[model samples]
Target: MGNFATLQPGGRPLVRFYLAFMLWFVGRAIQAAALVDPNVRKEFNDLPDDFSFSLGAAFNGPQMAIGKDSNGKVKYLGKNSNIVPQVKITIKSMEALFLLFTFRESTPVANSRERMTVEGNLSHACACVRILDIVQVYLLPKPIAKLAIKRYPKWSLKKHTINRLLINLRAIIGF
Candidate 1:
């Protein structure tokens, strides 16, 4: 329906499309959570204004943009472009990335296993992992989240319901 990674008759584009989709999927989940979850949003708020981060893989591999919008909200900067991010997180391979998203692996575990690498401040990297962990709780259901994260928050029913509703709305509305 759109050039939003519309399929092309090539293997490379196909892989790129898949990676882009995954990045968008995961990014939205994290961004939406950051908007509604005070702790997660606070992490971004504490960063320098316009702090930028990029995630990608090896040579000529798919890359995704993530940055603070003018309002200091964490948002996806979309497909890879010229924006130079202060931090870059690169995975060893698509398979490794897939494992992380699929909940077969966690970020710290992946780092220890040498599946991913980061070039930037260690504290920022840790913060990113924390945000991603919260995203996992919202994005993946209980069964998967339990497997992916070392600790899942035990939210009260009332708080959980309202947070879920707001997170989904903000995600769709692109706040």
Candidate 2:
């Protein structure tokens, strides 16, 4: 006699929710960073007025979008909004997203590994990645940030400490 067994796994809701929350927090941090960090602001200034970008998991999973307005201020546009973004960076799977967010794989490593897909203009995407790296350096502590960012920035006191504190506070307060 032979026994038959089959197994199929369902989606991970908790992972999806966690990724969504992280994306939201990162979006807010980016918005706040644009205001508090000169480097972030400078990057935003180089982009077009209508520029926008999104980071998310593929196949309509969790996501967050950020955009720069005519005034050159950046804002978190929420998840999967009706407004189409100029750049979209998508992780191939939940596992990949998990690894990236968990700091097991940095953005550059993930990109090199083919774990992410980028759409739209390449130059704009590179700028957005640089902005994100700056934000990560501000948001995370030195030890952990070194793992997440490709190259740790050579930041001064105001940028590494004062600006980091301001960015966190403003991001929490949503201004």
Candidate 3:
């Protein structure tokens, strides 16, 4: 209902907990998406194998890093801020970020709502959004995904089934 950043009840412990949980949840989805999506791998292929990106709420909200391995498979880098991310998606508040994670808002929609901004290379931001879209395909059903993305792709049935199985398998097994 309101910005969690402004609330700060109990010194913001709830906000921190929510941010931490979302970071892990979204990080897993990103890893699964990157493992199976050709385009995601293609996007990272041009970058170094150790390349990483981040998404978080601005003003000290939770942030998580998504890094690529030598094979371009995405890995979760934990909540540590030791390694600087090459690109960062900064949502203006925890409320906005929660909306995005819940699929009530998409990246483009959030940007239009002035709830999020991207800092660093613009192309990387675009690439990261694409990666998020791939994650949505695996995580959300068609009707719900329609709400989360500007465009819900119309892939063939065979392709969808195969991709879904592979993505879900890796995501569940943590491989």
Candidate 4:
């Protein structure tokens, strides 16, 4: 009988690490955007005061959580902890997460491609997606951000520049 071999199953550690970092930044950026942008603030405010969310790769992968704090301000809750978020957005696998973090696919695109899934209230998930789109616009450069979102906003110079800078600063400083 001829001999046959099977390849080993595997995981992408580097991709997982990258995803963890990106998720951390994105969580912080969302919180910061709510503080710096009136539109973002309004969107967040519309959510239930206790609203929280988690985004990450599926099956015990690196994840980040964000939600409103006691003062009703948005806060990055760090990695998943005791708090159970109202919405959880999970990417199907490490490859899909890599694609997402690398900007190879936008959130909407990934959803349409069936590479991602959401659990919880549909309306809240829609709001979270909108928040993410706006945060991505601030966090990434114009050309790349354009690729990351469905429709780019027509922002005034002050908003695109000043608010972007403030959001980046706040997110980085853990404000």
* CA-lDDT, candidates in order: 0.76, 0.90, 0.78, 0.88
Clashing pairs in 4: none
Q: What is the TM-score of each candidate against the true structure?
A: 0.82, 0.94, 0.83, 0.94
RMSD of 1: 7.6
Model 3 clash count equals 0
Q: Write the residue-wise lDDT of candidate 2 on 45-135 in tens digits.
A: 9999989999999877898899988888799999967789999988998889989888889999999999999999999999999998998
3 or 4, greater by TM-score? 4
Estimate candidate 4's alpha-carbon lDDT, on a 0 to 1 scale. Answer: 0.88
lDDT score at residue 120, model 2, on the 0-100 scale: 93
- Model 1's TM-score against the true structure: 0.82
Instruction: Estimate, for each residue in 22-81, the C-alpha lDDT of model 1 and write its tens digit.
Output: 777767767788767888889898777888787777665677767887788787777665
Compared with the true structure, the alpha-carbon lDDT of candidate 2 equals 0.90
Number of clashes found in candidate 2: 0
Error of 1 at 175 (Å): 3.6
**Over 4 Å off, model 2:** 1-8
Best by TM-score: 2
Please identify which of the two predictions, 1 or 3, would achieve the higher lDDT against the true structure.
3
In model 3, the runs with Cα more than 4 Å from the true position are 1-19, 69-71
lDDT of 4 by residue, 88-157 (tens): 9888987888887788888889989999889999899999899999999999999999878889999999
Q: Which candidate gets the maximum lDDT versus the true structure?
A: 2
Q: At residue 108, what lDDT does model 2 achieve?
A: 96
